[model samples]
Target: MPEMTRIVLAARPEGAPGPESFRIEQAPMPEPGPGMVLLRTIWLSLDPYMRGRMDAAKSYAAPVEVGATMEGGGVAEVLASQAPGFAPGDVVVGPTGWASHAVVPAEALRRIDPAAAPLSTALGVLGMPGLTAWVGLDHIAGAKAGETIVVSAATGAVGSLASQLARRRGLRVIGVAGGAEKCAYAVETLGCDACLDHRAPGGAAALSEAIGAAAPDGVDIYFENVGGRTLEAVLPRMNLHGRIALCGMIAWFSGKGAAEPMTLPAVWRMILTRRLRVQGFLVFDHFDRLPAFLAEVAPLVRSGEIVWRESVAEGLEAAPGAFLRLLDGGNFGKQLVRVGHDPAGT
Candidate 1:
């Protein structure tokens, strides 16, 4: 019998998760029961959403129980299959968690074509994050050509795609990021019209000034990602009827369950005066659009028009630290852990 390595939730974090929140454990390799498949994790994705799972909070998804594996999505290779359609050595992507292997229902996994794109991408640009960008900006926000659009976390998995997608639509896109490297990538590679460093001194005032200078015509659409100071900076500059797609509130997440103070009165006044159309979206709600999204984005990615960067942490042992870095804005792009070898050589 093979032994498997896994990370389990040792404690629920009240504030930002620390090393004590998780524990490493050894388990016997999982076996596939009827209608199920056994998988070996190849690439484990470390995303900000996983932070919510580390706490016992009300969310769209259930929190990881104490003493259980930390929940996450990963690209895996089928080691054995008791399910009808799946077979040994097939590549699939699903929620297999922070483990070297998993035994899951066949219905829960989606087969990935190695020929379409790199297998790691099933967790990044060509997968959930990319779909999030497309659905939020195109379907929810309904961004149009010649519009001035702003997206925070511009170099992140979802923000990168949203910023570029907005550009593809002939929108003048301004990206809000934390540092010079990311800001430069947004402008030079992602084709954003301008990129603002939110981590710069003077904070909100600096961001507001940059937005005013870049989008002097006023923001027609705002892809809301980091919500604290970035939201405050964007509020006053919104054009009449400007649309906001509320994707993630990373700043608030840093405070854990604690509510961060906001200029609600000012925000409401601007919303009323600007007639802002704001909608919060979850990517799973639009999973049905996967085929459509893949058809449109896959080609661009293959042609190098939709380029992306990755910051990989080697081994399952590194997942927790890598994830912490992701939440702290330390990662430059998509954060993934190479937990095991990719059989496809991608």
Candidate 2:
């Protein structure tokens, strides 16, 4: 039997997650059964969404049980297979969790070429994060050419990709992110028409000013990611017939189980007066759009028009501490854990 490494959540965290919240364990290698594949993980994607999975409480998806392997998305190399079509050494992406190896059915994973993009990207820009941006901004928010768009976490994985995609669509793009460095990256590197620093004093006002200066008309699409005071500010500035695509609420993840009063009155007034269409969505809701999405986004990425960033945690053990830091915005790009090397690079 093949022995492997894995991380399991030891406890539910009260505040920010600590290293102690998880434990690394050795497990027997799983054997592929009939119509199944044995995968050896290469990369683990640590995202803000994983925090929601740790809780027993209900959300868009089911939570990970206490002793189970931490639920996660990962890229893996098919080491063995009993199913048809898959060969040993084919790369695939799936919800393989924090384990070093996983036994899954052949139908559950899709083979991806490493040369199409970095194999790591299957967990990042060209993967769920990019899909999140593409589907949320274009499909859900209906971002159109010549319209104005704004996204919080502007330089991050989904936000950066969304901003650049918005610009390419001819929409005036306004990016909002923490720190001046990230804001500058969003504006200068990512080609956003304007970027506002959310950490600055009177951040909301500055954002309003920046959006006013950039679009002057108003935001037509608001890709809601951070969603606290950020939502409060963006709600009032939406143009008539604008759309708000609610993606994630990172601000709420840190203060887990703490319910804050929502800006419902403003949300309603804006929707009514300005005719805003604010819709909350889970990314999987549009999985059917994946093929179409890949067709549209892949070319842009290949041409170097779109940039993807990764904040990689070194090993399986680092996932817990890294996850905590991710909630604090301590991570710069797509927060991920590298369980193994990119064999493609070697």
Candidate 3:
């Protein structure tokens, strides 16, 4: 009878979460019930959205109650199955939460071909973040060649792919990131026409000037991920009839900027007068587009036409600290926690 290690929400945070917010404990390994598969988590994905799940507030999803396992998606190896079409040694991807082992329904798991790509990729580029960039840019924003587009979090999981895909489509891509290194990666590697560092002095005002210089034609489309000063900077520069795909607002996820004052009338007037098309979307609402997304982007990934980066913490104990660092703009790319060994090998 092997035991499993899990990290649970110990307490909710006031602004930013810390180590005291999480608790680690051991429990009996979960057993699969009928129509379920028992799995050992391989790679655990940490995204900005998880911050919202920590607060006891109403949102698209239920908040993770204190003392419960933190919710997350991961790639895992099947250890046993009571479900059809699954068996020991099968690698799968699903919502495995913050535990070393999970007993999940077969319907909730999707088997991945280890030969196709790295198994860890199932939690990154070929997974939710990849699909998010695709749907937001292609389906939602309807990005066009010859158009000017700006992507925030430019070197992040979703934004990196969005910047690359937009560049490939011949868009004049402008990127907004935290530091000089990430900004350089966005321009040199992701093929962005320009990249702005929001952390530079003079804050949003300086960023706005940079955006104006980069997109003298005015922004044709904005792939919005961070919604604080970045949004303020981009809104005034939006071209008439410009489209905005409202993705995650990571800046406000931890309630850091929620209390800031903004003139709603001014924002409303800009939208009304400019005829700006703003659409907010959730990735979960667009699962039907996954196959199409894979069909188009998978080849680019395989051929090295599209590249990705990952910042990984070595073990489960590192998750809490890594997650805290992620909220503070410390992660370079897709942030992951490696819980169990990858049988697929590096």
| Local distance difference test scores for all models | 0.92, 0.83, 0.92
lDDT string for model 1 (1-346, tens) is 8899999999988787889988999999888899999999999999999988887876899888999999999999999999998999899999899999999899999999888888999999999999999999899999899999999999999999999999999999999999898999999999999999988888677789889999989999999998888888888889999999999999889574244357678889899999998999999999999999999999999999898889999999999899988988989889999999987786
Per-residue lDDT, model 3, residue 274, is: 79
RMSD versus native structure for model 3: 1.1
Model 2 residue 301 CA deviation (Å) reads: 1.5
Q: Single out the weakest 10-residue window by summed lDDT for candidate 2.
A: 254-263
- lDDT per residue for candidate 3 within 120-237, as digits (tens), equals 8888899999999999999889999999999999999999999999999999999999999999999999899999998898877889999999999999999999888888889989
Candidate 2: misplaced stretches above 4 Å? 203-206, 256-263
Model 1 segments more than 4 A misplaced = 256-260
Ranking by lDDT: 3, 1, 2
Regions of candidate 3 where Cα sits further than 4 Å from its true position: 258-261
> Judged by lDDT, which candidate is best?
3
TM-score of each: 0.98, 0.93, 0.98
Please give the range of 10 consecutive residues that has the lowest summed lDDT in model 1.
Answer: 254-263
